[model samples]
Target: MNPAPSHPYRAAALLAMLSQALFCFRLSMPTKLMFDEVHYVPAARHLIALSGPVNIEHPLLAKEIIAGGILLLGDNSLGWRFFSTLAGTATVLGVFAILWLMLGRVRPAVFGALFALFNGTVFIQARIAMLDGYMAAFTVLGIAALLWAMRAESSGTAWSRWVLGSVLLGLAVAAKWIAAPFVAYAAIAFVAVRLNDARREGRSIYAALNARPIGGIHRHWPGMAAIPAILVLGTVSIAAYFATFAPAFFYTVQPMTLAKLLPFQMQMYGQQTQVLPHHPYQSAWWTWPMMVRPIWYLYERVDGAQRGVLLVGNPAVLWGGLVAVAGCLYGWWRTRAPALLAAVGLWLGSYVIWAIIPKSLGFFYYYYLPSIFLCVALAVSLDHFARGTRWDTRFLLLVLALFALFYPVLSAMPLWGPNAFHFWTWFPSWV
Candidate 1:
């Protein structure tokens, strides 16, 4: 393994800064609403304008952050997306830290940040104003905290880590409903860590368990004692989730009560079931893994000038991630390594939820969270690939190279119109 710098976060800090510059460079390219910005930016303006929130299906944290940016930047395009850019950059940093915590190595963590930056999933989402970007940042924190909490042998530190993870999970959902999977993820991790701790106390517990039957089970039930900690974790998360809604009550003139809130929630639920009028970009969850389709956020040509932003996976990181994820799953099954297990488990937790979201309408960008997890899974797999060769480092360069190749279309930079669209339209659905 390549030795990491003495300061682990330095590479990540550089990555975050670079990503911010990249996302913010042409901040007003289309100079108008781009993709989902139509729904979110107005809601943010509403927060400041004393207008009612227009988009309530999603939670309020992302809009609140965007509103802060708008308040500072004067209700323009840059203002609309400023906070999203920050959240996206933070996603890169958080990915790095999560890898650092998981691998305890500098090089792999750096690989994670670079992979996420060039992957185009997080970067595209980050550049635009959207709920998913905020969710991505908080998801990174939740996963990192869960891993740290799992690793803690000290009870107090473990509880604190769990609490932090719980609160972050709550905040993640506050940014978007899709992030609810993280809460389930933390609970699963907590149970696995405690059970593993119990089993490790002694191998003879197996024999003891075999012979003693109910008593043996009783004797090994220390894992159950951690229930209070689990309860506290749940409480903290719920409290944090409620706290995110306080602004909805305070900022608006209308008083929020259960009478008003209940129907509002049902209205949000109703929106989920409406697939309506056929969106060109929407796809099933299974297709996202294969990069079958991409959503077009914007396409504009005014007075012989052209600019566009396409939300598509950069094949370098996205496809490479699939191979790496397979490596992680296979290696974990073969070696029973805790680190591999953690990566695989986390990837599954974030991804599996999509299969059951109950939303009739979904898009390529919904894969954003899983795609970021893929980068981490790839980072973990690097430990195995890097041990005996330099091939893994070469792969990192190739990922960057691919990102460079796609930079123009990805960033909405001008090019010969047909060539630009043709280069990006590798598949029929992508148009």
Candidate 2:
């Protein structure tokens, strides 16, 4: 039997490469600074100049990446944005790699890559100098490495995977403090390993735990071969992560926690915890599932007077993914794709953290981080359908094609008709 003729992954990769390059350079006119570019541009400059450590609430990894590009490209709009575009480009490949790793299928990987490329949030954030895209890139990389570790059958292979996973995971945290929750999942993996070992030894882990000496817990250690593998990998990765911050952190980020450092952390924590009254763009997490209020990051008049404007995510991609999340839930219920489950956990977990926050500072863009995983969830469902029906693939391809066509007009161009370009105010809260 012969396999059905399919598009070569190399061809798809080439197309993906071209699209990302075009996307990175397309809006080279550099219309105007959008949203947080105000804050991060200066931050990148300081980093490139190797000035004093910039005291910031967020993590330093994104700025470090931007600094690298600025050093090479020279400090300017494009120079600062260059790293973001590259990270965005890398994200397309990352999505493909992650899907392939989790599902062990090529078709899903292609669909995932295509969907990620056409996604409006991805497209916009990737073009600008911003931290969000870098955060997403590291996150996807971490997920891919973690999945690789889980699937490895040999100690050597597993150790390599774990080390890669740990390095990437640490990078993720270094990209954003929000990544702290992912540690929960990491701990789950360790506990899972211990449980498997105890089971193999015909002893309940709980029994060992309830026993007299905690030191004897190693007696039931599942797969002694695997533990060293994980520890070595984890240790080295952690070392690398700390090494990046060590210059500023050697005295600050000490092994023995200092009382003075606690106040700085306390102040940072306070900012995240503080809630403001009546933020126009603020909305509840419950509504995010429905895509009710999307943040408008940039809107401007072009052509010397009026006519051109730019909004956020393409409505088709944003709204379509919202509905598709339901499909993802159903698909997961039916098939239980572990990849889908993992994505849902990350996506929902990030959002849930914000929803529970007493602070009102979270905004529409706050949803941006979680949106990537939501798209993955949708992609997983689409992959399931693509395998079952030709119509589904064609339908989704059409939807994406239509989205790509309208995306520029909806996102970057001033197509709303004269001042109508700014008529994207479907929700006053989003204004």
Quote the RMSD, in angstroms, for model 1: 4.4
Off by over 4 Å in 2: 1-12, 53-55, 189-241, 246-264, 275-279, 302-311, 334-340, 409-411, 414-418, 422-431
Q: Which candidate number maximizes lDDT?
A: 1
TM-score of each: 0.89, 0.79
The all-Cα superposition gives candidate 2 an RMSD in Å to the true structure of: 6.0
lDDT by residue (102-198, candidate 1, tens digit) is 6778777888888888888877887788889998898788877766665555556666777888898889888887887677666666556545644
lDDT of 2 by residue, 1-431 (tens): 01222344684578467656767655543445666778787776766555644546666688788777778877765677777877777777777766676566777666667666776677777877777788778767777676665555554565567677777767877776676566456656555645654666666666433322234433222223444544654565556555455334433223223453446556657765666578655667777655566665555564443332233555555666666667766767887655556556656776788766566665555666666665566666676655676744674576577666656443455454445633455565444
Give lDDT for model 2. Answer: 0.62
Query: Candidate 1, after superposition: displacement of residue 175 in Å?
Result: 0.6
Give the alpha-carbon lDDT of every model. 0.75, 0.62
